[model samples]
Target: MTNPTLALTLGDVAGIGPEITAKALLAHPELREIARPVVIGDADAMRRGMRATGFDTDALVVIEDPREARNDPDTVELVQTGPSLADVPIGELSAAAGDGAYRFVVEACSLVRAGRADAIVTAPLNKAAMHAGGHDFAGHTELLAHEFGVKDYSLVLSAGDLYVFHLTTHVSLRRAIEDVTVERTTQVLNLAHGLARALGRPEERIAVAGLNPHAGENRLFGDEDADVLTPAIEAARERGIPVDGPIPADALFPAAMRRGRWNLLVACYHDQGHAPFKSVYGDDGVNITVGLPAVRVSVDHGTAFDIAGTGQANEASMVLSCVRAAELAPGWGAVVDALS
Candidate 1:
């Protein structure tokens, strides 16, 4: 089988999305071997990114159709998904930049749904800018769910040996805890299990982190562990899912990282998982959305507005995002064979 077409979306013009994307494509020539990568964003912003990164190669080409891509290392194809952003200022959020980023994602998703692209790799987008531009969603996760009309989905972050799935994302800590019912936690666990399997893991162990310190210490702290977490874990196991805990938040992560005991950790809230995973992976992680209609992967880091136009951004995460997306494709093994 020929290489699958991987669609890339330029996140926010005011941030490091363009720079990192250009650098990733230029630095990793092997990307063209496994799939024809078609970039979806403003052409002008990409050009600026290419020049900023000193990637003076004819390998980059702009195409109108994803299928027309030739998978040539000498040509990274660009597909304009939004209007020209040549006048948009760098290092500063603007409605235009936010709209452009939103449109790019919408177009990329459309391609995947239409079967023109086999998978998607997204850069970072500024939430404030996205909201200012009239897109009222928390982040890419919500945007994707809304667009696809998917009722159930979860975010999984993979960094080297660590895998974390959040029980709640983009919400206040109080709201996060309130959202963690038995049903929601079980659903997240099931999604994590499916994602692990997709990534070649086989019914591996799962660890669920507690909502409170020391896992409620037998209700000395909170009833969430005893009342909510324990039942959820039991339900999962009863359904033939291998899982453990309501484990103490403080002890679970270190143990998982040190012993590799669990295939994935289900955190009760955002910071509970992200703080530990980011501490280990830093900026070298990929965020994957499970239960989507199409394979979608993104850099775990965000649009660093602080270093937007300075050419100081790292492309490692973005490159890994593309690699991860390729790995999750429907016929990824065949693509790997073609690469070999």
Candidate 2:
């Protein structure tokens, strides 16, 4: 089979997305061996990024189709998507930059749906800028879900063999607690298992972290773990999915990281998973949305406005996102089937 085609979306033009994309492609020479990356965004913004990041501008070649991409390590193939964003003011927010970011994703989704691309590896997009652009979505996961009309989705953060799936994200703590019902917990557990199976580890155990401290200390602190999370784990076990927990977050995360007890984990909310994962993995992790028709991977970090134009941003996560996208693209059909 030919190499998978990755539609790499350059997120918020004003932030570090463009700079990181340029840097990642240049920094990781092996990317050409795994996939053909076609950049989807404004050409002007990309040129500005190339110049700012000290990459040769002559390497950028704008093409109308993904099939036209040459997959050359020195060449950055771009499919210009939105309006010119070269003057959108790096290190600041602009409606034009926001709209351009939004448009790039839309175009990438269109490419995937049309079978022009096998997967998407996205750079960071500013949520505030996205809202300012009049497209109000929580983030890339939610936007991609909306574009694909998928409601049963979860934000999965992965670093190598470790995968953490969030039950609720981008919601207030109170709302998150309210939203952590048995149904949702079970859904996320199954999604986590689906991912494990997709990754060719169907027999690996899945761990569920508790919503309360010490997993509620057997009902001393809170009852969400006993009442909600436990039942979800039990039900998932009944379905013949190798599952464990309502384990305390503190113990579960440490064991997953150090001892290799479980490869798959279900986080109660965003920070429950994000904090420790980011702390340990840093630029090694990539965000994945399970239940989408096509594989979508993104840098776990956000658009860093403070270092936008300095060309000093680390492209590790961006490169990892692309690498993970290439790894997932081949078995993505199994992923789609398992999640659906």
Candidate 3:
């Protein structure tokens, strides 16, 4: 089979997205062997990135279609999506940069849906800038979910052997508590199972972290664990998904990371998963959107405006994101069908 073609969206041009993207390709030339990466953004912005990262100036080639990409190690294939963002101020938020980033994703979604691209590997986009540009979405996860017309999706943080799925993301703490219904929990469980199957581990163990401390400590703290979560776990088990939990958040993550008790984990909310994962994994982690039609992986870090143009942004996460996307692209169809 041919290598999967990936739409590599260079996110907020005003931030470190472009720099890291250029640097990832430059630093990891072997990425071309596994996937054909087509940059979906303004050509000038990518040129700026190549220059900022001291990349090969003569290597960038703008193609009219994704199929035209050569996946050459020395040549960076680009599919310009919108008007020039060459002059967008680095290290500062620009509505143009935000809109440009949004457009790049939209174009990528179009390509994926049309079967022109097999997956999407994204760099970070500034949410504030995207909102300022009038996109008014929560972030990349919500935006891509909307573009794909899917309501049952979760923001998943993945490193080697460990995957953390969030039940609620980009919401207030109170809202997060309110959103963790049994139905949503079950859906996320299935999504996690689907991810396991996609990764060739149909019997992979899954675990859920409690919403309250000590897993509500037998209802001394809160009833969400016993009342809301237990039923969902039971339902997942009945469906033949090997799962466990409503374990205390404090213990679940530590055991999962240190002892390898479980490979797939479901966190009740954003910080529950993000804080610990980011602390432990850092640039080694990549963000994934579960329940999309095609695989979408992103750098776990954010748009670093403080070091936007410094050429110091580490591309480790970006490189890993691309590699993960490529790895998942082959089996992603089975995942989507299972979710459906």
Best by TM-score: 2
Q: Distance (Å) between predicted and true CA of 183, model 1?
A: 1.7
Q: How do the residues 92-124 of candidate 3 rate in per-residue lDDT, one tens digit apiece?
A: 989999999999999999999998999999989
Clashing pairs in 1: 59-74, 59-75
After superposition, candidate 2 runs with Cα above 4 Å error: none
The residue-by-residue lDDT of candidate 2 on 84-143, one tens digit each, is: 776799889887888888899999999999989999988888888889989999888999
Computed on alpha carbons, the lDDT of every model, listed in order, comes to 0.82, 0.89, 0.91
Clashes of each: 2, 0, 0
* Tens digits of lDDT, candidate 1, 1-340: 4676788999998889888988888778987777677889988888878777777646568788898877666556889876799898888988888888889889998997898998889999988888999999889999988888786778888877567888899889889989999888988877766655655674688899989999999999999999999998999899887898989988999888666777589988888888888887777778988767777889988888888877889999988888878767864443233212
- Assess every candidate by TM-score: 0.93, 0.97, 0.96
lDDT (C-alpha) at residue 50 in model 2 = 86
Least well predicted 10-residue stretch by lDDT in candidate 1 = 331-340
* Runs off by more than 4 Å, candidate 3: none
C-alpha RMSD for every candidate:
3.8, 1.2, 1.3
- In angstroms, what RMSD does candidate 3 have relative to the true structure? 1.3
Clashes of 1: 2
